[model samples]
Target: MNETEQRRATQLLQLARNGDAESLETLLASYIGYLKVLSHSQLDPRVRGRLSASDLVQESLLEAHRDFTKFAGTTTAEFTGWLRKILVNNAARAVETHLLAAKRDYRREYSLDLLRQAADESHARLNSMTAVHRRGPASEAEHQEDLTVLSNAIEKLSTEYREVIVLRHVEGLTFADIAIRMNRSAGASRMLWMRAIEKLREAMSNENHE
Candidate 1:
């Protein structure tokens, strides 16, 4: 997010926290793309086909809306973190419903902790790629804005570029694995990934300038 966007978000957050229903709706709507990306990255592969990221994100957003009054944090990062927790929880439930419906020891197969850790790892990787650091302690709002910016940039890429980026970065797949998944040679996968990164960087650069 840029300065103008950040200021707007802060204003919306304050209004939402103070019981403005329309402001709350607007605030949550702004995060739909970011939430969708997080939901897609954190969803378990076993249940990817069974559950769509949009559905998971919608569920989470509804829950967030219902519980917005309970949220006490004052920064965008805290709000984003709260929403991510909801997304992870919903994703874990989806995984269990689809992948462990018949298993008696389903708990052994999956845990919310594992999903949360995966989300954290993905967040760290994305932050490393897109974050611009300053000398002093960076504010939480700045970190959250970086994520929002990156998510929007990713959403603007071509489908093939987006797929390669999610596979290589979000999923942490090796080039060989991505090659197999994408039905290309390892060298070809690497090339595609390079192109995807270049495009992504350009998109992010344009976003920052805007």
Candidate 2:
């Protein structure tokens, strides 16, 4: 965390702890995007419809706002990790409360057709990415393909892996930054990233074969 961020975080925590409502809201608003992305990545594909991501995000924000007291000794990694925990926990609760009460939807079938389509979409996205996304810039057609591949790859990642990847890679936090947000040592963050990459490679390979 930078000096400014550290100060702001400290201030927010203190305010929230003291029951300063607006300050708490401001603090949680700053982190809402990260929460939404985490929730999306964690959702099971088998489920669909009426799953309110925004509501879950709002709920998390409210809880954090109220319980900021418990979140003392703040570090950048711990902030992200705590946010992640809230999102994952909320998702599990949502599934149990909504989906489990009803019959299994079974609408999303995992089959050759869906897999091939996913692979094709992923390859296209990869080919289309800009200079930074897929190693380097590409021609217009390639750029579009790169985006398609990237999107598919992101969706294919497991929730846990996706959380780290989004924060560190997509959100552009450094390894140290990621470690702090994830509440892990730098070594663990590095290993998690390595594992995420390995999973991506496996996903890509499977796409190619299919």
Over the stretch 1-210, how does candidate 1's per-residue lDDT look in tens digits? 444365566778888888899888877877886887777677776777878888888999999999998898987767877888999999988877887787757676578898888888777767765554334554665666666778878878998898888887777889999999889999999999999989988988887778
Q: Write the per-residue lDDT of candidate 2 for residues 27-109, one digit (tens) a residue.
A: 56656644554455345434436575567788888777667677755544356456656666666666666666574543243
Best by lDDT: 1
What TM-score does candidate 1 get on C-alpha atoms? 0.84
lDDT (Cα) of model 1: 0.80
lDDT of 2 at 30: 56
Q: Ten residues in a row with the worst lDDT in model 1? A: 129-138
Q: In terms of TM-score, which candidate is strongest?
A: 1
Error of 2 at 16 (Å): 3.1
Deviation from native of the Cα of residue 193 in model 2, angstroms: 20
What does candidate 2 score on TM? 0.43
Clashing pairs in 1: none
